[model samples]
Target: MSNSASGMAVCDECKHKFQDLKAKRSFRFIVFKINEKVQQVVVDKVGQPGESYDDFTACLPADECRYAVFDFDFVTDENCQKSKIFFISWAPDTSRVRSKMLYASSKDRFKRELEGIQVELQATDPSEMSMDIVKARAL
Candidate 1:
């Protein structure tokens, strides 16, 4: 990852650092449970370059058939491409604000704030990304 993209390096168990393989780019996804349903959001390259959340969300499955995966043309180099998955599940209590009662009322803002996970593990991968989950956070 570029110094400006990720900002800095961090450890695996550490939510503050993100480590990607020699791959020119990196991607991260944080999942939240909204109204007992799973609402996934992209966390990698969070504040980096080349793609927008709308563009990333576009790649997600539209069928609502348990998953949706799409690839963005957001390639850093000819060899570097980044994409994310947003999985949906039904359950009201399965949300980001599940524990943060202070931010519970502000669901949207709270969900966005609790961005601390990798891509959805259960999402159907038509093209296996083999993505190694990278934690994204600031410390």
Candidate 2:
């Protein structure tokens, strides 16, 4: 599909495909907004199962920060095994608005890749349990 993050082509068919495949395989991805912005990201590869959030949060520049975190995992995986979590934050734009366009394009491309596997992605706001909640629900 078109990788233009400004409402990529996959957005049109992703929901339909997801609904069709939901019964066969439960593929879900969720987005969370951290309470504050992190100046830097600190993380380790392959965090321990069941303790990913702890490991992930520990990597932040501070315990409390505003950021967007994306989680991709299968619902059928009871233990959240093989789950992948992505944390992102905006950086100073030396390239002016060009970086924003690049990010949008990248996001659109990402959506297409996920649609290929029938994954449903949902973006939500930050809440009291932003970390714990995601840790509990994951994808």
Candidate 3:
């Protein structure tokens, strides 16, 4: 998406990669970061289909802000296998105020580029996006 009020444009590669994840299942998760110097959002890391949720979370810097989309697979109570696309905004408490504000302002526009996200999460810490919480939301 174009940088409007947020002053942060999402790079072309970021949108292309997100399409690969959504339509081709090329990735299990993707982590995005803002390049402050360029004032643009770019793909930071990607998780393969074999990677675990922990792997995805590990890509997030503990003291930074990031945007991520996770393709979560889970089994329903009826034993049906299901999957959900989760869009997560990760802004840890230790991150700088300017970074947090930038991420917050740019989140909606960034999320809109990755269509088909079924769930959304805003997390300041690991607990908020823990497996238990994600599983519950997937249900």
Candidate 4:
């Protein structure tokens, strides 16, 4: 767990779990949240393997900020199977300003700890990170 100058620390469990998702295929997605009391980023929820994207999205609180990683698998034009890891910053408009600011500020350092993210998404609303947008970015 590395602590950035901003006083945000990435908990060890966060890194280990991400490695499991990225390399071991242990989870479909992982949701992360900052523990304001400790100023540390921690794993809040994990979508089990075989969980649909909708399930992953459902795990996010509509009125809070969260960071998540999804393992997206799709077929290419050549019919080749490929998977892309996405790092998403979810900050709904209804969330508190302080929460949003903390998440935004802590994102980079937290993301760096999880090594293999291939794409990044910042979404303030569901429309911004719709499946269509994710697919376009994946391709």
Candidate 5:
């Protein structure tokens, strides 16, 4: 997955071949439009377990304005990108947009990750938590 953000990112640390199931690569970019230019952000990390994935993009932007806050807890709308495993989003430049960083895995794993994210984000200091909503799209 190619993301525009250079900050902390969610990377494919392991790329071993899988035989049990065909693994299709998926990507999500945390993006924000500033000055009419869409800026891609980094996904800091995911929590252990609810809601969705707890991805921390650019904290600078989320803290900068109310509109740029990206959520690591829950998504209120339908998925923007439709991947084999999860949903995604994109920008006009064909750059993958940030919504939720989804790892196609067991349904149980997905549920665990989602729940973990929700709990972690909720535990964070309200001031430190982000309000940015990532609209993920597939490229």
Candidate 6:
């Protein structure tokens, strides 16, 4: 079994063949629960290499998602061609200033945010992704 930074464990013999693995690229999905329904905002491309939170904020809408997930594309040390995906999600403390309450009230902004989140996921293997896994990661 291999342990990830998020404390997730996966026991895949094929994935463990290599000792070293690192993320070559990644994308962030921010999820929000509004009106009892969950929505998402996906940040697909960063404006610059090593973009900071400020850059992310500029791209982010005034509102925030209660949950977020980061999907990373990792390459094996033995063969760069051999790759896999790792997903990690988090829930931030938004009690201060009532971040959720301060969510953008603009309909257009919400529409755009939802659109971004609806973009296709970066998983190479579609079978590996499922709503159950996503829900588990959100916890």
Q: Which numbered prediction scores highest in lDDT against the true structure?
A: 3
- Per-residue lDDT tens digits of candidate 1, residues 1-139? 1123222222222223222311233433222222222232222223233555454444444332221222223344456665433322212233234333322333333323324322333333322322222112100
Q: Write the per-residue lDDT of candidate 6 for residues 56-117, one digit (tens) a residue.
A: 33443333332222333234555454323232122123333443332323223433222222
| Residue 131 in model 1: lDDT | 26
Report lDDT per candidate.
0.29, 0.36, 0.93, 0.92, 0.25, 0.30
Instruction: After the best TM-score superposition of candidate 2, give how far the Cα of residue 66 lies from its true spot, in angstroms.
Output: 13
lDDT order of candidates, top first = 3, 4, 2, 6, 1, 5
Better model by TM-score: candidate 4 vs candidate 6:
4
lDDT of 2 by residue, 1-139 (tens): 4433333233333344343333333323222221113311122122233444445444433322222333445454465455444434422233236434444344534433333332232322224335555445545
TM-score of 1: 0.21
What does the lDDT read for residue 19 in candidate 4?
93
Off by over 4 Å in 6: 1-34, 37-65, 82-86, 96-139
lDDT of 2: 0.36
Q: Write the per-residue lDDT of candidate 3 for residues 37-94, one digit (tens) a residue.
A: 9999999999999999999998999999999999999999999999999999999999
Worst lDDT 10-window in candidate 4: 1-10
| Residues 4-105, model 5: lDDT tens digits | 232222222211111111232222212222222222232332222222334433322322221111232233357453322221221122222332222111
Give me the runs in candidate 1 sitting further than 4 Å from their true place.
Answer: 1-25, 28-49, 65-139
Count backbone overlaps in model 2: 4
Sliding window of 10 residues with minimal summed lDDT for model 2: 33-42
Error of 2 at 111 (Å): 2.6
Those runs of model 5 whose alpha carbons end farther than 4 Å from true positions after fitting are 1-25, 36-58, 66-139
TM-score of 2: 0.30
Clashes of each: 10, 4, 0, 0, 19, 0
